[model samples]
Target: MTAETAVPAATSFAALHHRPGEPLLLPNAWDHASAAVLAARGFSAIGTTSLAVAAAVGLPDGEAATREHTLRLALTLGSEPYLLSVDAEDGFSDDPGEVAELAHQLWAVGAVGINLEDGLGPAALHAAKIAAVKAAVPGLFVNARTDTYWLGDGDGDGDAKDTLRRLDAYRQAGADGVFVPGLTDPGRIAHVVRCVDAPLNVLYSPAGPAVPQLADLGVRRVSLGSLLYRRALGAALDAVADIAAGRVPGGTTPSYDEVRALERSVSARASANSTG
Candidate 1:
């Protein structure tokens, strides 16, 4: 299986954003087992978590250190039975051409979407990356993310304005959708939806509105970015502490057989690909 075989999935993934009243719930996966389990659970799309990818490799996330890891993950999960998106933090470079080339590589490896964050950099620079990515891989859904709200002081008025301003620039640069994480206010979310012509994507926060609430706010996509990975890490620690303290760990742990099934599926896929 290759990117060419996954073209139909890219089209189907783009259509998921257009469904009325039911926004796409994209779960982020860190590796093959995680992604396979998520796909088996029926997630139509799965995104690679930069945090999990970096943490797994003992590297700092969002600092452009995981370019090779990100590409390898894309290659591994690209042919899975779900849409794949890579979180290329800051496009792994400040240069628009480099970002565009990354986008080309991601698309070549079977990722249908790429998440590019501005990291509070120059608005024009982020917009240029979006423009270049679109020009290079038009089929790759460019979810242009602005960290104004994520990285700003909690001043509602100023942050909202900055968010809209950056989103406007990215949208004009041909971004397929816009993401504003750390934005939890319902009224503010509605206002952002009204202001941006592109589909609105919000990061799901436990402290923020729920999925149904976001759908009511006119959001088209909800991403659980790094949340699942963080929770899994937390669960592992809790289980270890409970075992060390001689207490029964009480959590929903997957059965060993179930996990082995995931491994079996991966082996089966590899065998099929090798023989096909």
Candidate 2:
């Protein structure tokens, strides 16, 4: 797939339905190089992190400042040999139509999936937005996320109820998936999974439940979110600190040629696809 290439009409957002216990492990990539490298590593699908995309452009995360950069990334990665899902935070505005337009553009650029969040907004409004996006791009996967856990509700019972209410509305509005970022308890995760009709997508945390445990708990998608990007930044800082102290970097550095070869590989693929 390319910016102008025609994609098959049958491939729609409904294709994101999980194959039972085999969940989709979606890795978040910030740029074309990062996305291409992950695709090369055999990931069947890739997701974008709004935090990474915002940080890369020096904008505040969750402030709706990187729509262009997000779209550019989608256009760049959608052609890769894998499905692409974008994390479009809060749909960039409260207007559902604008959000639907964004989904339309994503579909035009070959994106097959997208993740939208409510950020604790009214559940009915978010559900309407989900329905609008689905109406605009019927084949684009709409992973509706709620920030009840990430923020908080002061009481556990209240938080659970709010999260469940949002998930119910999202499912009714035709969302293909529903995500809860901070729910990691195996029992609680299982409870939510059983409550929703759509596949449950959980954020993968280093301190959270392992993949096998999550699988056992019935999670159908595991999103890495910004963990990899944060780790990459930490590694860069560590390497710089080591050099400043006159110490060699500890990690295995890729040979200069190997890194350069990635550029060539991407260029070759782009050229070949252009001609083919």
Candidate 3:
């Protein structure tokens, strides 16, 4: 379907729920093909990774240099047959209204959800942005993320209390979910789950608790942020290294036509569904 209709149709928090045993394993995609492939493989939702989005444009992550590329990818995959949740770093601006405007654009392109991180920005300010975005697009699922552990220590008791205060502010500001990327302590995760009224989202890590364990810990959403994208980059580097060393790249590589067919297949299906 066209982005316009597709967005409104799927735009709701209902898509964010995870069945008790079925934890949300959100795959991060860098481009349309990656997203399509994941969808074909039965992933119900796909997320855009800031690292991949930035690296794809030869920019640095957390620096907001890939806004156009990020939006372009959103426009490309947003109308795909699965849900899309964008990783908008600090909303690309400190102004809440500007952030809300970006959220509007994302929704216009068919994104049903958005992941807005504070990146350790002022808690009140981030809360304002969340509230503004929700006011502009009430159906958009706002996943408010605090980077206390990712970026700061919160000092001591003061910091910890501040973190909780920020999370509470985000929840009161209408976040459908809350995310703390660097938090891995099972006790802390459970405590945060108890603290937030909305669903709790955690970043899935190789060293962190397993999916089942996270679900058991009350994490409603677990995102594979930048893992797939980084792995793809690693594979590219490996292949290049092998070529430079006079060694063949040994991996299950897709034929050129197989790669091309993905675009054709997904586009055709999307078109047929759009017109049907």
Candidate 4:
């Protein structure tokens, strides 16, 4: 609960992970409208979707091509009421210092956490990035992500040793949490949860375990990743098809005034310190 605690943001965000079973269900938002709506709906923390960030600019995802877009979006959402965690894919560079600088900039803009993915690259390099970020911004929660399952080139269940090794390294290097995006097996998940020293974050998969099941398996954070963006795209397609077939859209649509209110709610109360 954000503004719910009225405490230091990092403390509020870090506390969300220690609740034994009730994992923090972080929904990813793409733009101002999406983030605003999610915040209005009472999500204490919001994360940016890297996929949507790149796609919105007609660029590719996971190629380190969206750093500016990502930072610009973070600058836009950082001053909001809720805690913000960014999905900085691979930290947008190979050098540790660069990643750390990015973390510092994000922290300066009011981000409480950052997600750094390994992309199945060298585990040692990812660990270095994690360490550097923690050294630069001690208060910023670092959620170290490893893509062993996504790029393992084998069955998801068989990448246990590699996953454990990478995640453990990240933990030792000061990662506040570890994320495995493509992992969904209950036994494997519970296994990683048992092995990793830090909080375990698993990407929410529609065909895999639901929130309750994930909670039961001891997951501490569940990320939506790009699911919301993908679903929104699907909704747009469905709505257009319905209109063509002489049928109205089925999903809930916010009124124009209500949408406008989301913006005015923020702009109406400018900070007293703004010189302009």
State each model's CA lDDT, in order. Answer: 0.91, 0.85, 0.84, 0.90
Cα error, candidate 3, residue 233 (Å): 1.2
- Which pairs clash in the backbone of model 1? none
Q: Which runs of model 4 end up more than 4 angstroms from their true locations?
A: 1-7, 154-158, 271-276
Q: What is the lDDT of residue 200 in candidate 4?
A: 95
Best by lDDT: 1
After superposing candidate 1, which stretches have Cα over 4 Å from the reference? 1-4
Rank the candidate models, highest lDDT first: 1, 4, 2, 3
**Residue range 1-276, candidate 1, lDDT tens digits:** 365666677788889888768999999999998998888888879999999999999999999999999999999988777889899999999999999999999998789999999999999999999999999988889999999888887466888888999999999999989999888899999999999998899999999999999998899999999999999999999999999999999888889999999888889988988898
7-82: candidate 4 lDDT, tens digit per residue? 3888889999999989999999999899999988999899999999999999999999999999999888888889
Could you estimate the TM-score for every candidate? 0.96, 0.92, 0.90, 0.95
Taking all chains together, the TM-score of candidate 1 against the true structure is 0.96
Pick out the ten consecutive residues of candidate 3 with the lowest summed lDDT: 7-16
Clashing pairs in 2: 12-139, 13-139
- Kindly indicate the candidate among 1 and 4 with the higher lDDT: 1
- Model 1 per-residue lDDT at 213: 92
Model 2 residue 194 CA deviation (Å) reads 1.0
The runs of at least 3 residues in candidate 2 whose Cα sits more than 4 Å from the true structure, single-residue gaps closed, are: 2-17, 153-155, 273-276
TM-score winner between 1 and 2, please give it.
Answer: 1
RMSD to the hidden true structure, all candidates: 1.3, 2.3, 2.6, 2.6
lDDT of 2: 0.85
